[model samples]
Target: MKSLICLLFLALLSSPLLAQDIFSSKNTHFSFFSSSPLEDIEAKTEKGVSAINIKTKAIYFKVPIASFQFRQKLMQEHFNQNYLESDKYPYAEFKGKVLDDADLSKDGTYQVTVEGILNLHGVDKTYKEKGTITVKGGNITAGATFNIRIADHRIDIPTIVVKNIAEVVAVTVNALYTVVNR
Candidate 1:
């Protein structure tokens, strides 16, 4: 009887149900923001998505810049036409990990910090930020609010419109990812 119990324990340990899962692109979000004296501009393109691997804590996100539609038509045109040059540079991507030695046990909220390479307007910059994740019912939802400076990515700011746009822009990010079993 004891041998049978031990056998069952080892079998459970080897099963996929006991292991962490890495979700697919359907479980991610990528967005950006820019503040100008003309207005505080923000937009998100849901057309793009990302995926996360829970066991490895790997994250990958992609978004097509042309899909980011601004509220004001003129602003949208300016973004795609002048700044982003969407026809030439059409996408942004990020790939990295949540951080070192992080635990993601279910039933509590965990503070998560992510370090990744942000590719914007054809430039790649290293970035790091702290956020939170909630594991509920075998699923994890992560969210964070941070800021990014455009100049860091070599986004040229015309001196003529210096006052119109703020160098610093605040961003809010929220992504809910479901666990996938393999």
Candidate 2:
């Protein structure tokens, strides 16, 4: 635990652009859905961690692939063993910056564009997406929805189950952050 804290501090201090203003959440909610002609699949997890620097408008997220829970045990098992390969690639991460002029210290909701690289299944992909950030009463709430192509991340599906899984999955992330490391 002490080493983890030290690492977190190192990560925050290593960023030259970030100011001292930081917000973080360990219980971030993340979900994904796939609707296809054969079957509709969905899964959700709250075991995500995220942090943001108000000064630099930089954001980061990390979620364990094994944390996501599906309704069926077989589906979860297949997802981890066959699709995501959680044993080999354990986590998904995102590093990006908010492209907006709004002051994060103020209280309001802002529609912001974020550009970042998402690493999933050991593959890194550049993404430019939009999300909502709301600052109120000294807390921050952020949410975003995006689509990820399974093939882009080298997550191959067997031909037999191709109809069950969609080529693209819709992902949603929500985090409520409070001031941290101050």
Candidate 3:
């Protein structure tokens, strides 16, 4: 028994641990909404990524800006031209992590806080929001909502169309992840 204990202690002390990293990508369904007094609008981005590395404290997500498809062409044009500037700033990005010390290996619902930097329209803003994440059947599911003021991101609006756009735009993020071994 003493030998067994020594062996166990030695093994525990000698074991080398590679950093815990979470590899993820956007699942098929990701949606966003932009509403104006003139009309209610919605769109989706099919491609995205969820990345986290516990060791490096690196977290990032990317959504292709041009992938958003709206019902109206004029609205789409305004989004690409004025709000998102999708041609110049083609992708929207966020970097952060689950605020609470989350047990990724277990299956449960966790309320998490995400503090990250958002880049859009040639501007970067630090945003922290609360969200929910679920781990089920080898899949990671997350959803969050945060509001962005249009002017904060350097998105310019003409006075004529100011009424057509909302001053504060609410952003909703839904991301899905499939684990990958690194």
TM-score of each: 0.78, 0.93, 0.80
Q: Pick the candidate with the highest lDDT.
A: 2
Candidate closer to the true structure by TM-score (higher is better), 1 or 2: 2
Model 2 scores worst on lDDT over the 10 consecutive residues at 1-10
The regions of model 3 sitting more than 4 angstroms off are: 1-20, 53-58
Winner by lDDT between candidate 2 and candidate 1: 2
Cα error, candidate 2, residue 59 (Å)? 0.2
lDDT of 1 by residue, 1-182 (tens): 33422332232333344335565435245566766767677876665555566666766666677877678888778778877788988876766678956666556788888998888788898889888877788777777777878788677767877776678877665677665444
Whole-model lDDT per candidate: 0.67, 0.88, 0.67
**What would the TM-score be for candidate 1 when compared with the true structure?**
0.78
Output the worst ten-in-a-row residue range by lDDT, candidate 1. Answer: 4-13
Which residue pairs collide, candidate 3? none
Clashing residue pairs in candidate 1 are 37-164
Q: Tell me the tens digit of each residue's lDDT in model 2 across 66-88.
A: 99999999999999999999999
C-alpha lDDT (0 to 100) for residue 40 of candidate 1: 75
